[model samples]
Target: MIMTKELWEGNAAIAEAAICAGVEAFFGYPITPQTEVLEHFSKRLPEEGRVFLQAESEVASINMVYGAACAGARVMTSSSSPGVSLMQEGISYIACSEVPAVVTNIMRGGPGLGNVQPAQGDYFQAVKSAGHGDYHMIALAASSVQEAIDLMVLAFDLADKYRTVVIFIADGAIGQMMEPAEMPPLRPVRPPEERVAWALTGAKGREHNIITSLYLGAENLEQVNLRLQAKLKKIAANEVRWQEYSTEDADFLLVAFGTVGRICQTVVREARAQGMKVGLVRPITLWPFPSARIAELAGRVKGILTVEMNAGQMVEDVRLAVEGACPVRFYGRMGGVIPLPDDILPELDKLDAGVASGREVQS
Candidate 1:
């Protein structure tokens, strides 16, 4: 039976949902705003006979994830911004080996050891290739505790289904928020299937299998690149997810993701109350971004506002989606600062007025 409970923080809800999803292993290090995730798992997974390890460093922890996933176990790890950077090498390794693993990044400010406070600075790193090579992490952004739970569960399934890494991205505000959530029932673990012709279990009477990204010959490397590209095309076709609010009659559209998207929702409501036609496009899948949906809205709305915690990363995608049909603007706060609804209102008003004036306004 499923149980409903209240979790006061988004990280805790994600940990709980992983447990419910029958995640068998978790290996990670501690980091601010994300520490609660490990803490919750440490206390809970043990009683259930699940494996939980606190590795010496982020690098070691992600390597452990790679090792466990090779054995066909459901594995996960989490960190904040800086620690996530440290795990990039292992993430790339996992991608190349085609191992399924879930990684959650409770993002904080940074280029270095910047701040423990929230920021969307890692947008490019997470959705684009973080380590090296042509690879993509299935990136999901959560705006609330419920979304945190829902996406973590989905992340695990997608990782295993696609044989790739999945990233759950949330910021400090969403990680710290309180909400009621329905806890899904624990899933039963199925024993690993017979090793595929490719999986590297033990050789044991079978042809030895190698898990590697190294293709020394140019032709072989080209084939690998082609295969990966095909997989990405399929992912884009099947996995784009988003939320739209008050879009039908909107003259102004807002594009945002993660915690910033939730804030934009409030701004949209306020703008509507003031007799302005405003709407929102919240991208749930950050990697296979909801670009097509944004494009459709471009034909209807007068302008688009791309709000983020970073200076302007997703703004580029919005611009691409809208093409030259509508003006695209950006409003953001960086280095651990949050953009307030009051602060966002003026930008919305300016865009609304610009639409009225017949002058093209882009920010």
Candidate 2:
């Protein structure tokens, strides 16, 4: 197949990628920095005879996604930070019910109703706890338009494979930025016969399969929790993914994800140009968190700096992974601020200075 590269805005590229991945249904509401995803689906999905509905609100959209997912349809939704927060209850329901669904979050600034500027403030919400549950969803973070497209496809596959919700997360910058990206060849939606055995399809010759997150009995819920925990363990073991840049020999390591991770790559190069041994480790799978790799690098690198667009969420995870093997510091810009290489280099310099002085690197 001759795959042609085309320029696309981040949000539109994600919507197109979902279509190429055989999304049978898309339910979403309009929201800044991510509304394009819903708009794109509105036009394209209908042309292809797929389901596309702009629900009344994010709550309605996610519930619609839950219903479609229960029927084993490849369903998806897109939203920004506050919009995603509105869908949390439904997201948690999808989690415990063990339904495969895809959710794309083009994260914007917020603790609540923050601006539409790009921000990674949703890191904790995306990676730590999607909703009020002990369950986990596979979270994939993208740093570029091309990666956003690629991970959108991966999100659907992983969602089906694990029978869990998968979140394709990126800062708003990635959603609005336009870049050349090679889309995957279009794939056909799975046939109804290919749907999972547990789908809520009409019962015929086989025993009816019941799926629900509500287990009123305490003991019954415990068993369900145990099963979910086991599944999470399996995912963490098998799905940890990260990229290492110039880590072959380094005195310092820069750890980040999404847009900040992309910036840190430039930080590594610029620092190296000045004869500093700096490297970067960018986590792609945020939940199955590449912790083991960071732990190993911690033992070798003199210090690690975690740069983020949040106050400092992922840094906690980084600190945990390091386990005091070395000093772990944090630098961040909140409320839709994008941290440039220039802003990050000085932080790296401080880390270097602290390490050289044998002083503790403050986070």
Candidate 3:
């Protein structure tokens, strides 16, 4: 099959990629930067005779996804920050139930009703667990439109492979921006006979299948939690994905993800041209973060600078990964403000000076 690159907006690309991945249904509410995802699916899915629902609220949308997932259908939902928060309870239910589902969070700013601008403020909520209880969803962060498209496809596969929730978190910038990208070829929808063994298709020929997050017995709930933990360990061991640039011989490193990660590449290039050795570690998977790689890089670099579009959320993870091997500093622009190369270079300079002067600087 021939593949051609075409200009694509990030939100629309996410919907298109889901369709290409054979998403059987999409249940979503309209939210900025991500409303396009729902709109795209609304038009495309119905045309293809697939489900496209505009639920009254994020609460309704997530539960719809949960029901479809239990039926072993490829299901998804999209929302921004506040809308996602509303779905937390449903998300936890889906996680505990161990059904496969895809959730797309085109993140915006805020602890409350923040603006519909690009921000990584949801980092902690997403990676630490989007809802209550001791459960986690596979979280993937995309830095570009192309990566957003690719990760949407990967999210579905990962969700099915793990039989768990997968959250694809892309900042509002990516959702709003447009770039040239290649959409994956369409995949045929899995027939009922091909659904997973655990699906609730029917119990005619076999024992009934019960899918629920509620384990009323104390021992039963403990066992369920243990199984979830084991699954997370497996995911961490096998799914820690990240990209490194210019680290062969570097005095300093830039650690970031999503839009900030993309911007740091420019900082690395400019810093190199000015005779400063710099490198970057852009994490693709936020949950099973690239901690091991960052630790190794910490051992060799003079210092690490973590840049983010939030008030330094991911920096905490970087600090843990560094483990005092070297000074880890954070620089961030919060409340929907994006940090450009100009905004970040001075922070790197400060980290360099602190390292040179045997001092530590914190963000």
Candidate 4:
């Protein structure tokens, strides 16, 4: 299959990816930095006889997704920081109910109603707890328009494989930035009988399959939690994905993900040009974080610097990975600010200076 590469905004690539991946329904409401996703689905889905609804609100939208998912449909929703917050309760329910749905968060700055500009402030809210629950979802981060498209397909597959919600998270910069990307051929829609074994279809010859998060009895609830925990473990073991750049032999390591990881890539090259041994480890799966890789690098590198668009969220995870094997420092720019190589180089320099002076690196 020949895929013609064309220029596309990040949001457009994501929307197109879902369409090509055979998503039958989209339940979304508009929010800045992510509104284009809803706009695209609204215009394009009708041409394919698919469903796209601009629900009254995010709350209603997520619930709509839940209904679609239970019926064995490929359903999805897109939202920004505040909007995703509202969708969490619904998301948690989806996870516990074992529904396969693809969701996207084109994250932005947040506290209450934070600005709509690009920021990675939703890191903890997404990776740590997509919603409040004992379950884990397959959380994938995309750093570029192309990766976003690729992961959009993978997110749906993983969702279906595990019968769970999968989140494709990218910061606002990637959502709005324009880049050339290739879209794979449209996938054939799954037949109703073959889509899922336990869809909420009416009882016929087989026993009816019930879908709910509530397991009222104590023993039954504990058993459900145990099964969920086992699934999470399997996902972590098999799905931890990351990319290592120039870390073969380096004195310093830079850890980042999403758009910030892309920035750190340039910093790595520039630092390498200046005869500095700098490398980067970019996590693609944030929930089943590449903890083992970070632990391995911690022993090899003299220090690790975590650069992010938030004050410092992923840094906590990095520190946990390092376990004091080496120092883990943080540098960030919040409220939709994008960090540049210049902004990050100083942090690396401080690590070197700290080493030379035998002093602790100031974050």
- TM agreement with the true structure for every prediction: 0.96, 0.98, 0.98, 0.98
The list of candidate 3 runs beyond 4 A from truth reads: 361-363
lDDT by residue for model 1 (6-110), tens: 655777888989998889899999999899999999999898888999999999999999988887788999999989999999998888778889999999988
Off by over 4 Å in 2: 361-363
For all candidates in order, the CA lDDT equals: 0.88, 0.93, 0.93, 0.91
Evaluate residue 50 in candidate 3 and report its C-alpha lDDT on the 0 to 100 scale. 94
Query: Tens digits of per-residue lDDT for model 3 on 1-363?
Result: 999999999999999999999999999999897999999998999998899989999999999999999999999999999999999999999999999999999999897988988999999889998688998889999999999999999999999999989999999999999999999999999986788889899997899999999988999999999999999999999998898899999899999999999999999999999899999999999999999999999999999999998887899999999898999999999888999999889898999888888887442
For model 2, residues 47-163, the per-residue Cα lDDT tens digits are 999999989999999999999999999999999999999999999999999999999899988888889999999888888876997988899999999999999999999999999
Error of 2 at 161 (Å): 0.4
Query: After aligning candidate 3 to the native by TM-score, how far in Å is the CA of 153 from where it should be?
Result: 0.4
- Kindly state the number of residue pairs that clash in model 3: 0
What's the lDDT for residue 335 in model 2?
90
TM-score of 3: 0.98
Candidate 2: C-alpha lDDT: 0.93
Q: Flag clash pairs in model 4.
A: none
Enumerate residue pairs that collide in model 2. Answer: none
Better of 1 and 3 by TM-score: 3
- Cα lDDT tens digits for candidate 4, 1-363: 777899999998899999999999998999999999999999999988899899999999999999999999999999999999999999999989989988899998877788988898888887787678687778899999999999999999899888888988998999999999999899987767775768887788889889999998999999999998999899999989998899999899999999989999999999999899999999999989999999998999889999999999999989888888887888999988899999999999998888678686533
Which runs in model 4 stand beyond 4 Å of their true positions?
A: 361-363
